[model samples]
Target: MTSLLFVDDETKLLRILSSYFTKKGFVVHTASTGEEARSKLRDADARIIFLDLRLSDATGIELLQEFVPRYPNKLFVIMTAYSDVESAVTAMKAGAFDYVSKPAKMDELEIIIRRACEWLDMKQENRTLKEKISKMMQDQEMIGVSPAMKRVFRMVERAAETDATVLLEGESGTGKSRIARMIHRWSDRKNQPFVSVNCAALPEQLLESELFGYEKGAFTGAHAKRKGKFEAARNGTIFLDEIGEISLPLQAKLLQVVQEKSFMPLGSNQTVHVDVRIIAATNRDLKTMVEEGLFREDLYYRLNIIDIFIPPLRERKEDIPPLIEQFLDKQRAKYNKPFTLPPELIDRLVEYPWPGNVRELENAVERAVVLCRDEQLSIEDFPREIRHAKPDRPPSDIALDPTKSLPEQLESIEKKLILDALEQTGGQIAAAARLLSISRQRLMYKMNKYSIR
Candidate 1:
């Protein structure tokens, strides 16, 4: 139910307005003075507020200015006598949702209240949608078709079907967070909130208060009770990214919530129970941390109920092609350009060792797209590091005679090119094959026959 607060100095006006709104099925709360109104606001989660301009002790515009910034989400409407048009205009500029004249028509007031309520609803919906979109964009899909990736996909599919806590383990930039979101998206709780918290982003005190809300007067400057992410994500999934970064004490608290499904807010005696699933991802080795006494073994066991490990880009060269295509499409749409990556350029991309993994590949693609002028992208569009790549010239290139047989000469050139690609790519066979404009299998066969390392 939506809460409404009305503040007016006139006793009769306050009673009449409050009674009328009460009959309209709103939980109406009234105050006869600005002081009383501010006090009531502290206790009430009012979504819309109505303040009279001609207050006995304070100007309505002053109160509006004071409250708007503090509670920007709450919709405020100012009321004044018809002659007080100037004050009403001032209130509107100060963030009043609307202004009403004294002795206002009941029909007009009802219409204004209805519209204010709608605005509040739409704003809340937009906020929720934006959060979801931000999470989705950050959670790039797991891109790989290799056996390793296939195994990870199978684990993800199984994990998505259950409510068990999932612990994603992998090196930095290996898309652990992406795997977490995919699990949430495929779960039955997909329609609910997917709240993510970066355990390493905040200090321990702030992080504690964030995970478990604080009551009003709970601490200095905590003037009002705030809902924590766990409560906000009721019946949803709460992804604790960088969970390993949290201190041991906080980890115990988190484990309690995971096991008991309840937590107490800071400075509050009562416990708040919630139905939230926890998905944690980390680049650090938790087992080592556990052995080193940095992480709790019990919590580690609980979170590792279902483990999904994301392989790094260097280990899965087979996935680079698809990832490049996906990133190119995304970049083209973002930049509003119709660009196609040349096959040769993609081949060069496949040969590069992406130290930063898929994220580096994405940034490289975006950079190339921005630099590209023609519809077809070339090697020149790539960064200087990639464009200037060249293999070491073999001694045969200088020593070969021009009088050799055509087939033998061609074989010599092929061997030299293959060797050069292999050297440039740090002996990565798949990358070398891509540079040679041939399938990995064919390159492997040729390498075996030619006795190439």
Candidate 2:
């Protein structure tokens, strides 16, 4: 049953109203002073408070103002004298549900309470709907049963335990960005902002400004001071997607942020410090870029503290069925056309090498959902490319390391030694650096270089 509270100095009215409401199946509470009423409001689960306009301690309007903003789910009805119409209007503006003049009929009071309950219920329902929509908008998740994904899951769990920089390396559209989100969601900073910037998507000029916020009037069109992703992700994680595509100058700024935990925004003189965890993802080989002098060595070392190499979807064929089912169900729900793929269609889909990876598979499923005439999707319903696609080669057929040169092999060995030393000493950088015969800063740079997280 819903609870109701009557806050009035009038002992006679409070007694009568309390008895009437209790008999009508409401759990009634009464308080004389404003202070007593406030205590009751906090302690009790009253949905509607029938508040007197004038109390011994304070006016009902004042109490209404204090509580309306704090407890929006609860309704406050002003019980005012006929001459206090102006005060009643003020109470309404301050978020009171309604006003009932003194000596009001029981029928009118009941109707007002009923209406307020309905409105509160509607607001709660609307909030629930919005939450569902938000989850749908950020619906991407990993779906795989392969050993490769099992390893990725273990890596995710390990990375979640600490606030280390993580680098997700994979082919384009292989769900590296989604895995970044998974890492953030599982980390200690999950409650804080998870800001992401795609280095390849923005121009060099704008990308620098977007990472570190600028002061007001720092640049043309800079009308107001705006906080960047770094500031916004305070005590949280900031994901840099397609990080390898970032310009060399911007990489220098990023290296400073990683090394010193500070950076000056574009067009700003003052340096802003931030304590944020970084998670960067890229398809490009940072080692190759570093060797070619296209990428900064220091920045590469800083970003590559903890590396998670995600195998492309084509390399994990065993995961295809579950991935297809998940995508099909999602697209069916989205398009309002629930359907199932035929056995032959499923076989063909699993055989077709997903060159675009998970992204391409999702598109294929959506396309099938939109064009299928019946509940059972056939080969003809799929895209032309998918229908005629060749089978993918086994993972064993491909190169395990993929780096074919002596320097690249040594680079791989050096990364392993650094990671092994860090692990043996439980992430004590100075000790790990000593074991690797490198300075502390050098080891730090090396860990960042290889992204040992």
What tens digits encode model 2's per-residue C-alpha lDDT throughout 216-311?
898899999888989988899999999999888888888998888898876788888999999999999999999999899988878888899999
Report how far residue 344 has shifted in candidate 1, in Å.
2.5
The parts of candidate 2 lying over 4 Å away from their true place are 1-140, 392-453
**Can you write out model 1's per-residue Cα lDDT over 314-338, one digit (the tens) per residue?**
7888889878877877877787777
Model 1 clash number = 0
Q: Give TM-scores for every candidate, taking all chains together and pairing residue i with residue i.
A: 0.56, 0.56
Q: How well does candidate 2 score on lDDT at residue 114?
A: 76
